[model samples]
Target: MRSYLTRLLIVIQFVIIIFGLLQNENRAFLKQLFLRSDAVLFNGSLYRLYLHQQKPRDSMLVASHAVDDYSWLGAEPFLVIAHGLGPKLYGGDNTIKTLVKGRERGFRVYEVDISLTADNVLVCYHGGDETEINAMRYADYLAVCRSKGQDPCRFDDIVSYARKNPAVSFVLDVKNRFYDAYGMIRNAVGDQNLGKSFIPQVYDFEQLPFIRKDGLFAGEIFTSYRSALTNRQIFDYSKKYDVKVITLTLQRFVEQKGDFPRDLVILTHPVNDPFIAADVKKLGARGIYTSYITHRSIPELFTSALFFTPLKQV
Candidate 1:
């Protein structure tokens, strides 16, 4: 019986060793796969993706075009100021003034309209029914706002306001289900120049356009908690479309770690804590979208001017 017990113990040890080896091999395989993917190649590098292929003069032309046409040149890091709700719900004027101030300080401001009224007007609000808004025209919404003692301005008026103010760039957050809203915005901003100035972000996947790289609205693909696609899938989609920026949650950023494409711009919630911000910077985030930029007058927090200082060298 003692001899049998010893044999059983030996078998158990052998099984444990096999399991350990398998685990190690699995981890190594995953590491190799990640390396093969080349997802993290552009981290901490200052290389342009399309620069090598294009000519020196042509590259400058493209850079200038992106800056002038695509809203790239104004600042190192872009500041996307989302005005939540209307003037009645939140202080709308205060939000606008703060954004204007940010733009004056050379930060590009993208204001999102989130209200879902039937008229589908873009006056700057958060999370409303897209279907309802598109059903109602912007003209009707203006009348409704005036009746309610609110400022009445058409979506075109907002674009005009941005045009008058050279520093400010508008990110029109279309929170409606109307298929033609994208084309409507393009037509409204007659000049291709003005159309290019606007970045239209869509929350619904069905609403997303197949070819959005050209024209007025750059798509800001919103990934919520209930999103079906994984971080890698989102990154791949963005790369395929040459999408310059993507906005997602802080939790998703942590989970994905180095999986995100280096060329894509990431906009996440502001990390208030300096340590957290430092870590986020190391992870290679382009910008942090927050109301903190409005509340905090200090420019450094909003701007990407500060370099990440290493606590310990890699």
Candidate 2:
């Protein structure tokens, strides 16, 4: 472990020096880099470095079986969630255009934020000041988005799209309002559709009781981004509730120590850096929630952890 840490630190320092030198050489280039997404500015570039330094196998895997429409692996070539629709142009805006762009990139699972409007309607949003968001009706919010040319979408809009495309799935991040937002989604999409298309993320272990009682969603993901629980406690609660997936921030996972059962799926968030992604995989994380990483960027990194097997193994 000591030697591993030494090597890791060396690699990180090398990356920083390389980027710093490049930035110093061309200030205009740095400004252009600023225009890219958060993942692109650092993580994506780091991933390019990883590809060069560590020559992972360069091959594509063919699907072994037909897509399971009810499962999360309908079109998932990689075990990644497209954070905020995955489009750099309007990333985290949660609009129809963003979803389209993410789909174009072959992303089958998307993580989107949803909040309630003034009239108790659920809309895809990541707004601060919930009181202010709660003061605007659905129509008022739509008008505001149009005035800003954001092309916003509601929770229902996403559900409608999902019904049309059964291959796609959504991971809902309702922030702090887990129960209220989930109730609204259940009503809008119905329990059957909710089971088929949506995976609700629970923030706190306290929400597990409600999850157990409701039993509407087919699966649930416990995201420890805001939760105060330790990794072991979270893993226990997840196992108790049959929540198969657990997501933690990269820093959080690195800090925590414990063994997660092999059957449980572990994922880390906002991992666009292939070096960090590989490190987390060594630590037992099976997947990631990424803003910019895609199968096209590095297919080799995803070959091992995919949900489906390739028909013809090389």
Candidate 3:
């Protein structure tokens, strides 16, 4: 009787496992697991069935090394923008030290948060209350940075740095009062380099017309994290404004992957994991805004097999 009961329990557990495997909530976990290039004993009919369910007639997934794994990313080369000057190496985000470190590591593009002071000075800062920071005078802001042992960077300093490194580009994250920030930058860098070097990130479609009317900016990237527009509206406005790249949160990307136009370059933010980055890239992300990943680390990231070779259906 004991032996019979044990066998029945084993059968029940097997059934439960099988049932869990087929559930929708578990599909994502299973997808990540089976897609791993290093997954052992995962090459049988079960793998084939999962692939078939995800897409009816896609190519068979082949396991390959990191070098070949990202080959699908295309010849354009994946661009990485240093988030807040690439992760507080010298101090916190938007500091001159971090910016210099990012540039040394071969990052030509950087995202800097620009806050306008009460004295109407443009500075690289993102902290505390936006209104309170905006209300403080430039001198007072500098004093505050000194008190906190943080290095403060002004727009003038950024312009000077850009003048020295002409190839560098800045993606301005001006939370509110974008027009004021734009005019200040234009005044500093001149109208010629306003759009070329200092790219303004518009929060919504309404802000586009104001920036677009003057033709002051050469390019504009739609940062959709804060946007309320539907995917269709986002795509439509992108075309109308000639926006070449659109940025959204990773969660947003996962939810609206099918709605986004594949032809456009879609960028996602704050991806630190090489595995997650690989996953998103395979899903059609062209670039990422990261704090840890850089041009210098790509080869090392691959050699270590952090980006595992999945059972890819070609």
Best TM-score among the predictions, by candidate number:
3
- The TM-score values for the models, in the order shown, are 0.58, 0.67, 0.69
The lowest-lDDT stretch of 10 consecutive residues in candidate 3 is 62-71
Put down candidate 3 lDDT per residue, 217-238, tens digits, no spaces: 5466788765545445567667
Clashing pairs in 1: 114-125, 117-133, 118-132, 118-136, 119-136, 120-133, 130-176, 130-177, 195-216
Model 2 ranges off by over 4 Å: 1-70, 73-78, 90-92, 129-132, 135-140, 143-148, 191-194, 212-214, 257-259, 304-314
**Candidate 1 TM-score over all chains jointly:** 0.58
Per-model C-alpha RMSD:
12.5, 13.6, 13.9
Q: Residues 217-306, candidate 2, lDDT per residue (tens digit)?
A: 546678976654446656776666556778877655665533667777888888877766665666677778887677777676767653
Q: Which stretches in model 1 have alpha-carbon errors above 4 Å?
A: 1-90, 93-106, 114-116, 119-122, 127-153, 202-214, 218-226, 270-279, 294-296, 299-314
lDDT of 3: 0.67
- Backbone clashes in each candidate structure, one number apiece? 9, 0, 12
lDDT measured at residue 199 in model 1 versus the true structure, 0 to 100? 61
Give all candidates' CA lDDT scores: 0.50, 0.67, 0.67
